[model samples]
Target: MDATSFILPLAEITIAGAIINASVHFVPVGGAPAAMATSTGVGTGTTQLAAGAGFTGLLAAATMASQAGVSLANPVHMLLIMLSGAVGAMIMLGLTMLIGQIIYVYGIGIVPAADKCEKDPITGDIQKPYITPGTTGHGIPTVCFVSGSIGAALGGLGGALAYIALQQLGFAAAIAGVLAVGFFFMNAVLASYNIGGTIEGFHDPKFKKMPNGVIASFVSSLIAGAVLIGMAMGL
Candidate 1:
């Protein structure tokens, strides 16, 4: 491997980290409050949601890349692999939100509302009136669902890119997959820490802090990329 190989993979890893961090910002995480129907979004942390969706996407992309005729060197093939990952992630997150929504509406008997905004950005529904007093909100709203879908896609794409980069550097399938998961977690955690707590998707004020998380991921990724290059050299 020469300069281009080293530079390209390093760049991919770095960019993938940044992208993953940004994606987490788009997910709605209501934490403990959401669990009891006192807040919006799914009742989970950002890292858990992101990692779940991202791992699904990573598996999908890896499966596609392993097809006999699929070549990572081919730009079209690469795009398809990434798309496979994105779609997988979207499906996973979509189902999660859908099921959670059902429980929130039917079981909990509360309307889906967003506390961060006065009205729904996508549906134009008034949010304030539906919100229960003393609670931030209840259930996932249309905007949050849309934002989470987008985030899942991005997470999948980023995870796929990292896996691809590792494969390109001559890492075996299993090794690359493991490394990709570790890398994904690293960046996801950075974004989660930046979020500090619950968030209501992209429309939330906390989303403004994305750049800080992105920067942290970028720097950490660069260091991780250098270490990966060294590992590849040993292999």
Candidate 2:
């Protein structure tokens, strides 16, 4: 309605976009190589994995916010909503990694290994020894698992923040939710392209390129935020 109301939501949208982009970079995506056990990480593109986790979180947060006595205007209630989102994302990604691990180990008969490092950064296990001669690595290793979980949590938080901002601007829940989803995807896709295909989470050298993705998301989000503000004015 006023300058203060419009400015706050725009800022939140911009920050949420940047945060979503950064979160995607933390996830480990192996693309085609991961599917055939030739690389480390989940067998999918970065955008897909991030979007899956982010949407789950968004739904979880929305559910929490809709509960009685959970007012978004209250800081504690908002925090609880964001927490629900983070936990939801963690559960989804954790389950995915666990099932994928089971398939890679027992079903495919290959030891879990990391291609980007000599030893597991988190567990300190020697990675080179377990990897097959012809493949880069197999399964979700400790580092990848941890990194993916962290990424999921952040992605969920970002999604929740965007939704919260939209709701704060007086949009109905359904409209806010749809806008948040679109906003999340825009940032996630930008980060995925910056990755250029595959990444082994934080341990991978490609993680160093995160600044590029973040900057891209920032600029794009600012534009999206302005557009949303304009729409809000009409509403």
Candidate 3:
């Protein structure tokens, strides 16, 4: 049946969440600069999602309003488009979450557990291995930030389309998706090179040896995209 009622809320929430994340990344929560001021940005891209989502939402709204002039069509038409948007947004969100999970649990997160010591020596086997930025390369955070933004855009745009579809018909939904994706795509290019050094404090002597941040981002995005596609089906 594709009811417009439930789908509207789902679409809005997903879009809003992504936008908020985008906003946070760019808005700079504290008085200081976002990433560079920090010890190291790591997964700091989550903060920026808010702004991206907000802008995307506004664009979607304008689109739906304009198309209203076209015709007073069937509610079912609106519902179907809304369903598509919902499906798309869910796909994007699921992907980002999956990537986030991977980053959190593996790579930077998978610190070796300190319980495998066998010999009962005087020093007690030092247990956990430390992760100094010195051990990693510059590309790690860079990759993560880039990947996160891609995931956010995919999710947010899907959400924006959902919003328009909920209110109106075909053209509006398409417009919403286009606007959201376009703005985000432009931003993606910029975020790729800039985020790592600024957010994760990549330049800090400690992280000087850390791995490249770019690879992490690319891989994360891949995992996220796959998961999002799976989620879209459910939506």
Global lDDT of each candidate: 0.95, 0.92, 0.36
Q: Of 2 and 3, which scores higher on lDDT?
A: 2
Cα distance off (Å), candidate 3, residue 191: 20
Q: Write the per-residue lDDT of candidate 3 for residues 69-163, one digit (tens) a residue.
A: 43225555444443443344334433443454455346445431112122112234332243333332211233234333444344344444434
Poorly placed runs, candidate 3 (over 4 Å): 1-42, 46-72, 110-235
TM-score, one value per model: 0.98, 0.98, 0.29
Taking all chains together, the TM-score of candidate 3 against the true structure is 0.29
TM-score of 2: 0.98
lDDT by residue for model 1 (141-218), tens: 999999999999999999999999999888999999999999999999999999999999889999999999999999
Per-residue lDDT, model 2, residue 171, is 88
Which 10 successive residues of model 2 have the least lDDT summed? 1-10
Backbone clashes in each candidate structure, one number apiece? 0, 0, 47
Ranking by lDDT: 1, 2, 3
Error of 1 at 51 (Å): 0.5
Clashing pairs in 1: none
> Least accurate stretch of 10 residues (summed lDDT) in model 3?
112-121
Give candidate 3's whole-model lDDT: 0.36
